[model samples]
Target: MSVPESEELCLDVSGGRSGQGPATWGQQAIWDAVSVLGDDAPRYNVSVGFELPAGRPRAAVLEALTRAARLHESLRTRLLPDGAGGLTQVLDAAGRFPVTVRGCEREDTERAGGQLLGELAALPFDCAGQWPLRIGLVEADGLVRYYAMALSHTAADGGGLRRLARDVVMLLDGVSPERLRELFPATQPLDQAAYQHSERGRKRDAASRKYWCAKLSEGPRGLFPPRGERVRDALFPNAVLHSPALLRAVDHVAAVRGVSGSSVLLAAAARQISLLGRAPEQLLQVVVNNRFLPGMSQTITTLAQEGLFHLRTVDEDFGDLVRRVHMSALGAYRYASYDKRLLDRDIEELRGRLPDLADHSCFFNDTREPELFRPPAGDTEVPPLERAAELTTLAWPVEFPPRKNLSFAMDVVDAPGALELAMTADSALIPRQDMESFLRGIEDAVVGDALATGCV
Candidate 1:
């Protein structure tokens, strides 16, 4: 397949209330991460693609996009320095958003669309100057076949992306803007900023910080003791394990135990980490999606932040541990939202007394939707655990430069009839052997529990 030539175009979007305000908590959280990443900031961009109907008019698609950009203020917002080492979001009433167009054969639309999405996502957004949204279109036989987009994390998270995609599709189907607003009224970023800076918001922030600091002071100071020297081939090694048995086992356990699949997986991971570190307590930074809060379900902005998970390990069965995890998770989610700047200050102040306080650096993120863990429809039977386990595979995909204060990080993502666990660990603290064991242990722990409990 030859590379398709591309041309740049612009869609003129206008007519939203122009305003400026301090960045919302979500924006600030992502901005802090991006600042740490620096040149790797593009890795935070969210990309999505849609296949357009045959014979879809380019003009109609452009119009729908224009309406979507106008409807979501985050799409038109830019971040600028506020002179006091802070960020201010500036929402413009009108601007031109660039769109990359590629003409390709019908058979090549999929490849072209994937390529376009990668190209669009590879570049870092100029958050201070450029709008946070980028678009690309693949045309075949004089009609639009596919469209791809890359959104800056400062503007949207996974939930926000879904809402934006839904609104654009509705608009493309000829829904009027007024009716669309009535159907899915969205809370703008400016509204969120206002509420977050209000007195009530300050109280919530303070409470969150207090909860976090308290946990930090009480939980394990480090997950792994530092090695005197590096031993692995890379500073940060990334590994992925795809396990179908783990998926089936997790589903069955979730159904029987009346807990979430995520809780099961989190408990398993915590167990392995405690065994490795020989610690009676485990502390993990769990990413929380804050859409459950009031007025945030349909908000078109980033609202994810890390919640502190502190687990005191005891001699208990896996089911009991899972229940404890479920309860602990509720508390973590409740205290997840706060001002990152204030929390940093609190941590710094505490570090003066407890020097090793900053050594605890383990993170867990589960990206699966809630509905995915539900019981299947009638007559659907889970396969035998041994049979599914036979198909498990492990691979070392990539290595990354050292991430600051990171010892171990685990991410759970959905795979076809399976669960994919990706891990990145500091090689000095956790060698490749331990990394493999950690990933495999999660699968084994879940599967073994399901079989032992006769859940499958």
Candidate 2:
């Protein structure tokens, strides 16, 4: 990958009205961390790349991007600390979204483009200094071959990224600008914040608070104990355990137990953690896509939040355990959307009632997609996806706020044929061997149960 001389074009987009407002639940959660870590925490920054169809008009491509920036208010938004030591989202109604046109030789475009996409994704966002989005166009042989966009996680989430891709394709398909707005409109973060503060939103928050207080009243148990030598430099190692048989087993068990695949997987994970930690109870936070609200499904904004689920049981049947985990996840998902600051206050209040209440930061995130990305079929001559012009997501290690012990995250990616269960652990905590055992145990919990139930 090489970087040659590049020309910059700042395209000013219009439509959004300059305004200031409170952040959304997801954004607020990220802000809470940014307040302490600043630019060190890059987990909230997201990037995506798309291969443009070959022979497309360059002017049309540029126009589509300009319209996209205007369509999504979040792309034009930036956050600043309020006078009272909090964060406020400022929407730049008229913002100049720069698109750097970089030309790579046809032969080197593939390698250079991939490297550029990664570097763009890794670029840190200056929360207080700039807008939450970045756009780039990779061209070769006088034709644009690739387009990349990086947005702060505060602006959009995994689901929101897909929505952005869909909208851009629609624009390129020659949809009327006005009709496109009506079809795929941006839901400003301010509107989401207003809803969060509404009476209905308040009611839901109260319910969520009550549920969490009850769950954490007994205090958080240490799920993974640090042992042996620690890495001199703070680093985390992630390992993925993939198996087709285990995937089938998970589906079979879920079918037999009348639960979703997620429920079964969660149950298996909880069971494995309990056995590995050698504790009756295990504390694990589940990342939920808090998009249950009306219009939020298509509304591109930060909507991912953490849901706490504690699994404490001994000698329970796998099926019954799955049912219990399923019910717990239901509550967690329902209460996932809430102001992080208020939620922290509630946790502190609970401390008085339950003296043993402690915090456990280890979590589980299921980022599986039902189906992979399918390019939009259109009349335009879309370029073939080659080594140079490919579409994919980049995952990098995330840095958390200071004063961190061992933080583990179990991420699951579902594919058409198998399930990829990845266990990521801070090197200071469990050794490589233990992490491997925990992952294998999770696989066994599902496959073993399926075989026992004759469902496999």
Candidate 3:
């Protein structure tokens, strides 16, 4: 495809609260992860695009963009190095944000928008020097057709992005900033940092640390014990399983069992890992959105952190396991917010006695929205496990250079009439064949149980 002609438009954004403070816990957590990737950290960038209404005025779009940039301090913030060898967040009250305007044929608008997204996201942000957000506009026949944005993970999580996107829509429809605030009030990062450093926040941090340390000491040192001398591989292999059967099975099971679909999937994954590694208990670092707290639901900043999930698997039935997982996940989410540095210190101390405590790096992240698991608006029957399994597809998509402190990781995402579970594992620990088996096994476990119970 040929490159489209493009020009730049600058929006002078100002008039938002600005200040400097220590990084929030979420910022610290993401920084730790990104710092490890170094040059590859651009992979953590979050990008999204939307089609514009027909004949939308460019001035209205620009106005909406400018208001949003001012409303969310994260959009105009920079992370600079603190003199003590740490990072500090500095939110600027005024800055000029440049929007790239690409001229493309109407038929190629979407493709060009995607190419523009890639161009904007391909480079790593100079956190200390540049703002955390990038914007692009795709125009055809002198009208704006689509808009795209690339943001640093430090600025927002999935929930934050959704909130910002919703606000932008409202702005385009002529909603006043004051009215928007009334409709969706949120706490900015600077204020959040102030509260986090207060006594109440300290208490929460302490409680979280105690909870995490107890779990760490109680769980097994490693999920997959060292088989023998280490055999290293150059890259980690990734496998994806798209199963409509699993989706229906999970929904049926969740409804009948009175649990969330996420718990059902987590239970199945825990069981599979236990059976594969010959371990009676499994420890996974599950990602927590941390949006349950009051006033946090609409905050436009990153607040996600890892919660330790420790579950023991014996001969228990799948139904019972799902209930237990639901309860355990609640506790994990409760303690998911904490000082990353403090937690690291506590873990380091615990490792003095439990040397292999850090060996386990299994992670589980569920990115599916709750509405996706809701049953269709009518009486629809779930296909049988055998029939549903026939439509399942599995593939190895890509490989990455070996990641440090990573053994196995799985992410749950939405698919058309299906649930997509993607897994990446160290080939040294889990061979490529085993990775395929693990994913398929999860599907079978969920679907077979749903069928056996006649839940459909």
Candidate 4:
């Protein structure tokens, strides 16, 4: 199967209504993150911020924050809205204040984070459920040290967050981003909300409901074990090894084979499941994202259309598998355009997108957050990772409830091309050692690739 060139898309986003914070973190975090209004909350909410070292000047960081305030209106004014669904964004009348400050210890990250978290508790954010998401920074080394930034998932997705970091670097060097107003499409969340409330949108919503009901005709059935203890972190998926070497090799092969990242991952997953002793006829479910639709990107709104990708752990070679996965992805991408409304109208008792229930764990690869997505602009230089570590770094982990049966949260680092992939699952289903072993296999696979041929 051949993949076509990607076309830029837009999404409709609304300004958002001001709302109070929730009482607890458990489900509230997910609810808030998903419902965030200023832009797309559900799809773009997860983020990671970086702290970097300064060579001679320390003021650039502060300058960058100031610039951010000036550029984005939501950062300036909080939110207020009419009793109806419409929203009003208020930029703080007082000149935009720089939110960054230097601290002496590693705990500075915690200090800043606590303050912001407190703000989320008290203030009403534009979107409901999404509280303040931020990271703290501290300069322990004193002389020309590094700092970091943590933003909430609601404001931007990993890609948007990285873009903002590049902007900061540019400001330090006296550069500004290309005005986005020109390239940006007109599909704001506000437009989507208006459409969502319309008679047409209502009809669409109803059709979508019927489509889901028909799609999922059977009761729930999965092989996952139940949780007995109060889990501290998120889900714990069973050991599933995606060899780094195999991953690399597949990519190398794809360059010569002319396929995509999704093709390689899917093919590999199908093989892995088969290797795990699943019968060839067994059904395996996969999650597919629909971000490439017309007017999906840039709209601060959740625009993903979820669809299940069913595969079998049957007889197939790696190349054949890659081709199959590519074809499946393209098919799903096209099929998602109708929304649930059309499905209901066309088919009876069709199933809606749900978690993996076919005795198989989900394999989702959203590499959008990787450094490759956002190029270095405005002559901004990203400080070395080593420099960042020299400074104090605090990771106040945000525990967003598990949405799928098991999730793979792929977060991108601020650096040009790095990614952090996190897989969460129910603890009862997988133990820590098992998880470690699975990772070890991937490491081995990556190492194996390097040994066979000088390839990273």
Candidate 5:
């Protein structure tokens, strides 16, 4: 495959106003869209890619990108205010723009990712005219091509990425766009946001808040150096270096122990913290989505909340802690609708919190994508994907480097499961090995967290 000196990639934004300007979509609608995602809105991006037949045409690729953007009502959206206080995405009377394609260095895709992630970290976003996602076509020999797609986390999620890939394939094959639809569109994000505020939701919310309010007060326990450091530089893990046996152990333990892969992950993190913090009082914050609003299962918005666990790292059973962590996750998932911004009193305010909280650990579960969304192998036939051009997933930025004092962000991607741990810390205060040891502890906890608890 000849890497092109210049590549033509497209960026098409579905949710903003144009020529007729705000006439197409109102500000109220746009705000509502953003409001629904809460803090998760800014971090959202859906990406997927596929290979075309031996002789797939480049023109076909272009058409696929254009057609799919035109087809989805979501792509034609604008984040506007709902007038009362929240935000909603107003669909343009006409929902899409002809795809916008540009030519840049093959390296452009890489730089774009770094910059986009930084933007997500540095700014609180507004969706008007925002290009939340982008598409790239890379040459895969004369007749074959590959697609990479990237998006703003505010708009679509990993599941949405799967839909985008499937749709692009359908459109390229000449499927009519109108009849095209998501497998579970009713579970769209907007509907979920409404459920969060519903009466039934309130009951769930009360219980979750009480649990975390107590958990958040406890100190962190991990392999964190006294000066603190970021998770990425510390872990130095890009690919899985551990044995398959270890990864298999992670999965098997999660299942036998009645936990999600993420719960297992947090447990691992706790174990590492216990060793690193050196004291039993160390703390970390986990981010959980409140997206279970009844019907909105497939929506791409971020409905999230935080959970802080006071880990019994020194002498407790791993099984018990895993159960406690699992239960805490359930509670948080149920009530994440109540963003701290809306807490009943003064201390509950997000603004009132520390300016430095960004330095703490915030765990997110993208779920191992394929495992989270699919059924048993024979459950359903996944059709061959289509798109006019190759897609690219590197458009979004990576992240902003952390200041002194460290933090970690965990992401699960396509490769065999491995942690994409990111961190920020005072370089002068902590060395890199401290971070690696902390990450190893997280890995070790999956097997021995119970041992740590027993010692306590």
Candidate 6:
């Protein structure tokens, strides 16, 4: 897994200025997680590759990256640890952005390139020591064939990474930063930090605490039995259920029920957990992206927060529970954004009052289509040469980090022509066979709902 010294090129980014600010709430949550995990945790490293069209020059690739580093403050912001146990984001405007140009042998370029991406994906971030962005260029025959960038999640979320890629391509096409700033004005991460400390933000935090306190008061402690030991891994081993039929069924059911696809999917998953785990009540930690707020949609930072969703005392009938799950999911999304540190404190008090609250570690996240994948606005002036070249992101496989006290986590994303559900769980608690059966039950429940609702 070692990269050879001879095949690498390093360049120090120059002419950038420097500034300082506090980390945003989203950044703080990521910082805290990384601090706990230390340097070995790759839980937050996001790596995305772009296939270089044949006509594009290698110089444009490098220039675009350097420009990106200079233009995007989040990529250059470094977290400095305080003696009193806090983190401050230091933005090096003129700091050198490192670009690693790795040349692959012509014969082994394709295979080695894939391996290289996975290796980069597994590398941890040093938030307190260096810039949060790492760029890797794959070269063959003196031309840049493919390029990949790995970013710390503290600076960007899944959506932000995609946006970053789009901007890079736009820059490669010779779009001026002024034009970009006008067309897609980004809300700087620092601004978000300021808002998190504002009086309004404090009020929002209080509202979140009240919502969660009441939500946890009625739920059973947890969905899974006590394992008695905390797992040190950032994520557990998991399996995926990808089905075009399932996706169609979910959409059909949602249409008939006048609900979102996410609601239908959530209902199906909760139903499966109730049947398989034999827990009449299920507590799900649902992840929601808080970018829907004004002036924050284009912000390139981590804005994802978790909201607790409790499915309790449901009647055995599956159809009735779907309505309940949908309503609960709506309520959960409403209270998803909040100060994590404050929310954590409230959770502790709630757990004390309701001891079973300790067992509610299961999570669900429905990542709908990312807006970053959309085509850049056509109205913006751009060169025909850059327009001729097709640019898109390449997906890379990344391992999930282990979760402490997490029995299972279910993630659903909309694939091209299907819905994909990836469930990661602790094998010691929910065995492989049982989880597989749970997946089957989800499909069955979804299909049954679609049929019963006249969606067949």
TM-score of 1: 0.92
Better of 1 and 4 by TM-score: 1
lDDT of 5 by residue, 109-227 (tens): 44433433343243454456643455555443343245556654445545555666667776777776655644545343333444545686556656666655544444343334546
What ranking of all candidate models by lDDT puts the best one first?
1, 3, 2, 6, 5, 4
- Candidate 2 lDDT over 217-305, as tens digits, reads 76455666667676566557667776555656776788888887888888888777677666767667798877666767677788888
4 or 5: which has the higher lDDT?
5
Question: In model 4, where do residues sit more than 4 Å from their true spots?
Answer: 1-47, 51-63, 73-100, 105-147, 177-188, 191-247, 277-291, 295-306, 312-315, 334-421, 426-456
lDDT of each residue in 1-456, candidate 4, tens digit only: 222122221211233233222111112223334454444342343434444534324445554555544554333333334355333433232332213334444445444434433432333333432223333234444532443444444344444445556555566666663444344442443344446556876575565444334334332244334424645655434333322233334445456446775555555544543443333432333333334545545443234444445453343445565667677666545433233333433443232344432443444554443223542334544343333222322232443454544523222122232222344444554345533443443333323333344443
| Candidate 3 lDDT, 1-456, residue by residue in tens | 679778987788889778899888888778778888877999998877777757467788889989998888888888887776577999998987768988888888788888998888877877788788878889888888888888889998877877787788788888988898888788888888888899999999999999888888878767775533455657787899998788788888898889888889999898888777888787789988888787887799998888888787644688888899989899888988899999999989988987766345999998766551332323445566669788899988999877778889999987657789999988767877878889988898899888888944
Question: Residue 138 error for model 6, in Å?
Answer: 1.3
lDDT of 1 at 389: 87
Candidate that scores best on lDDT: 1
**C-alpha lDDT of residue 363 in model 1:** 94
Question: Against the unseen true structure, what C-alpha lDDT does each candidate score?
Answer: 0.85, 0.72, 0.83, 0.40, 0.47, 0.72
Q: Estimate each model's TM-score.
A: 0.92, 0.83, 0.92, 0.56, 0.62, 0.82
Q: What does each candidate score in C-alpha RMSD?
A: 3.1, 6.2, 3.0, 11.6, 9.9, 7.6
After superposition, which runs of candidate 5 have C-alpha atoms over 4 Å from their true positions? 1-50, 53-72, 80-88, 95-126, 139-144, 166-182, 193-214, 217-245, 281-283, 289-293, 310-320, 343-367, 370-400, 403-407, 412-430, 445-456
Which stretch of 10 consecutive residues in model 5 shows the poorest summed lDDT?
Answer: 384-393
TM-score winner between 1 and 6, please give it: 1
lDDT score, candidate 5, position 71: 51
lDDT tens digits, residue span 199-271, model 1 = 9898889999999888888877667876547654556889999987887788888888898888888999988
